[model samples]
Target chain A: MTAVAVNNIVKTYGKKKEVAALYDISFEVPQGELFGVIGPDGAGKTSLFRILTTLLLADSGSATVDGFDVVKDYKAIRKRVGYMPGKFSLYPDLSVEENLNFFATIFNTSIEENYELIKDIYIQIEPFKKRKAGKLSGGMKQKLALSCALIHRPSVLFLDEPTTGVDAVSRKEFWEMLKGLKQQGITILVSTPYMDEAGLCDRVALVQNGKILSINTPQGVVQEFPYPLWAIRSDKMLALQREAAKLSSVQDIYPFGEYHHVVLKKGSTAAQLEEFIQAHQVDNAEMKTATPDIEDCFIALMKPSIDTATDSLNENASK
Target chain B: MRTLKFLLQKEFRQIFRDPSILRIILVMPVIQLLILPWAADYEMKNIKLAVVDQDHSEYSRQLINKITSSGYFTLTSYSGSWEQSLEQVERDKADLILQIPLHFEQQLVKEDEAALFMAINAINGVKAGLGGAYLQRIIGEYNREVRMKWIQFPRFNPDTQIEVTSSNWFNPLMNYKYFMVPGILVILLTMVGTNLSAINIVREKEIGTIEQINVTPIKKYHFVLGKLIPFWILGLVVLTIGLTISRLFYGIIPAGSFITIYIFAAVYLLAVLGLGLLISTHSANQQQAMLLSFFLMMIFILLGGLYTSIDSMPEWAKWITRFNPVSYFIEVMRMVILKGSTLVDIKMHLLIMCGFAVGLNGWAVWSYRKRS
Candidate 1:
């Protein structure tokens, strides 16, 4: 059975009319699978996680966690699922031990019963157990939150933007902890805006503007980039970007650290691109055929959807 | 039941972990209860009086002495002109002016009557009114004495005398502290109960911890109860401290048994804490919750008859006090402590408070949405 399933979920906020925060969002996580939702801020990732965890209700859709309906069997689902919100939300004044004990007791379980599940993460922060959560570092706080979320031995865990603001080392260690949890057969659905983290997930759904742009394995998403891409570099990257945009054969130009990923117009070859760069008086320009990564795919998928939304908005204003 | 216990444990830990909240809950009430009663005293005394005696006759002088000796008035100015005396009132140095006409003694002997005028600074209306009444009583006594000496009436006569002797019950000396201490105790309890719980829940929302609790399996009633019980316990502690202060400093012992006061207080705390939770559930942040709670508490304390009598309030205000839970508790506290009222004696108040407890808390729990 699928550990979690969502069908045709739609959510809108505001009172008088509405603003769509999520539109027809649907996905399924197979039992013991790790799924990631990749999106920027305000991409409705938190709203989706809230709906799936039964903390909010979708306007017109259905979801089930561990075979329990999101609306009807909310009690059972709440017991079986763990939710760590986008914000670090444990009681700030409470000591680490107190926070862990509180969450465990609320779930009708004791720390002794679920000690093994959180032992790996908890051991690292054990020396700071007596300190208040507000006094802990960002990484320690995240670990403590994860420990509290998992103290009940939940079947599924939902983490929203868990590593949005942490040191690079902590973010890497946190992912390792998650991988360990996934190995124990717990379904984990995590969301992050970091494109590099997408490679770690078994599968990923790229979301933007409350819409799913694409869903596939990280490698699969990269493999499906429709256009032949090139990385172009010069001494003056900004000036190079401006001059390259003026090229008639250039389809698109996006700055990716130390280079720009340029898609050529149809029937435009690399020899023509080099000739255009030379003709534009660009010095020592280097160009190479490049493989499209998830970042390239994300920008490629996001641009047109934004254009269509803006087009509709303009269309509405004209009326 | 077990869920409630665990939730309450979490709540208590959070409440005690903060030193500031501990001071507010445990120490602030003791200081307020100790100090507030002294400021809230309503007895009017030491009223400054200015006598404008133009006649300078025996009757006028006698009246001036009687007024000055009444212990309620202090002679601030004794002038011959109304303008001089009015200046004293203008400077706020005198609260009342006793103006005697030029022919005051001559009129009493020839016309068999005399008229005296009083001008009072009514800005502090309560003080002015009480001072005027006290002066009037002293003048009445002087009139009777003069009448007895002037008209030599026989001790035995055909006329029958009907005298009215009044006695005070509950508070023989009419000590304002006796009335104010219990009422202030009620206000203290309401403040600690409402403001604390209101801020408590909204702090969770502001800090984003409420979302973590919302995703748990805890029932809404259990959450509300968990939030309420800790503050409810704190409120009772405040009440006990207030009562102890009243007893130790002011020598106030409840005329009724302690059980009656606690029984009423427990129910009152439920209603008040329920109100706090209601405000918190509706507010999105701590500032809104604090402002909303302040607005409601101002209305509650004013209409609760802490400083004024409900009977003297306008009809509409009295109607509002009927719905005010603080008013009921204040009245119950006064009745139980001052008047020695038992449970049976205050059954109506107890029932109304219980109704408020059930109705307000039921609405609060219903309005608290776990899935919002």
Candidate 2:
């Protein structure tokens, strides 16, 4: 069963109605599946989450959550779906326990009734349950928010960048909690800017500029990278990058941590690229064939559109 | 109904937990009630009189003595010439000048009438008007005394003069506190109700908690009612606190029943809180809501006939008072507290208040969107 189904959803903003926040976006979350919408900031991830949660309306097309239409049957969908906005939306003055109990009661259930559902997340923040939610640490606040979102035992959970501001350890713990929620037969549709978290989802829709570039499993997305990719490194990274851009065989080159992940054209090889870099007198330059991760696949799919956008901007600048 | 209960629980908990809200609820009323009435006195006093007595006769002396002894004027300057008294007014030494004309005693005895030219500094119009009226009344009384002494005892009253003895009804003492305390209490209730409820929903919007509630299965009316009820009760509590403070500190007991005041207040708060909630619906954040409330409140309180009588207001301002909720409450408070007006006397006010309550709240609920 499909927990969420969205088709051709488009949203626009601004006074003149010019900026498109979402452009013909379509995807689905299977029942009990851990689905992810992976994209960078302002990539329409939040917009999609808002539309599906019925906090916002789409300009066109339709969506449903747990078999209820988002626009037409919003009330029915609201009762069954749990949405944690990217921003922390719990009352800051209320204590953690009060926040949880408040959400539970509003949903017409008691904390005692939903104790089994939120117990795992609740236990983590239970020690500071008496403390105001605003006074809690970032990780603990997220935990309390998740607990409040789950207190009613919503069948379809929508968490928009829940781990956005969390620390490394807390991010890992949050994913672990999501996995646990999935085991209890809850379908989770989570969005994040971090490419690493994509692997954790059962499937991810790589979104960019209000459009979904690809929707597949982590490995499946990686396999969509269609060029021979190589990671090139040197002491003089900037000089090497400038020199490497001059090569006709290099399709794309962008700095990634200690190395620059470069995609070579179909007829080229890593050895030829290494030789070409050495000829540019870049010191201690090294090259190796690198497998594309979700990040690499994202960049590859995002490049053509970004180039066209930039090209049009340049065209306007020149005019 | 159950959803409303939870929302109310959360709202009350938040209201109590926030120190600023508690300060507004608890400390504001005590301080405003205890201090405002003492400062807001409207009775005019101590009008400076610069007397220029041209007629140095016994009657003129008696007149001067009577004017100074009336307790409304302080004889600031007694000068020889009209120019000197005019200088006193220019120098801000006197509020008004009393110029007694030459041959004043002779004119009164021979001509049976006297012409007194009074030059008044009309700046600070209320002070000038009241002072002029006070001095005129004392002079008129002195004329009556002189007439009584000249006329034969029993034959004086039967035919010549018609005396009008005026009596003040309701508040015979005309105690400004009796008039002021009820008005201030209305203002207190208005400020507390309008400001607190105005910020309640916008505070949620500012902190983004409204988004969470919007996504819930909670009904819009339930959400609006939850915000309204707690503040409505708090507003009544403020009215109660203000009434108690007035009774204890100022010795003011309303002539009418407390039940009447409470019934009006219950409806009055609905209108005011409805206004607040309406502002919250139109605003995007606390600051915007507060500024909007402040702007409207300044207009409401000033034109609400608390400080000034509605009958005395300009035609345009009077028209505004017809629509102003604060004006209606202040009018009701005065009518019930001072005049002991029954519910039937204020039935129109009650009906109009119900109109405000329903119209504002209906607009608020209609504008308050759960899905936007």
The numbered model that scores best in DockQ is 2
Q: Give a tens-digit lDDT track for model 2, residues A1-319.
A: 9999998999999888799999998778889999999999999999999999998999999998999999999999889999999999898888988888889898999899989888888898888889999999999999999999998889999999999999999999999999999999999999999999999999998888898777888987776567798998888899888878778788889999999988887566677686776775547778878989988877777777345433433333223
Cα lDDT computed for each candidate against the true fold: 0.89, 0.88
What is the C-alpha lDDT profile of model 2 across B71-126, one tens digit per residue?
88999998779998998899999999998889999999998899887778898888
Distance from true location, Cα of B71 in model 2, Å: 2.2
Query: What is the CA-based DockQ of model 2?
Result: 0.71
Q: Which residue runs does candidate 1 get wrong by more than 4 Å? A: A279-283, A305-319, B84-91, B155-161
For model 1, what is the C-alpha lDDT against the true structure? 0.89
Per-residue lDDT tens digits of candidate 1, residues A226-298? Answer: 6668998887888889888877777789899888999766466777678766765546778888888989878
Angstrom error of the Cα, residue A192, model 1: value is: 1.1
DockQ scores for all predicted structures = 0.70, 0.71
Backbone clash pairs for candidate 1 read none
Best-performing candidate as measured by TM-score: 1
Put down candidate 1 lDDT per residue, B115-158, tens digits, no spaces: 99999999998998888899889999999888878776777854
TM-score for the second chain in candidate 2?
0.92
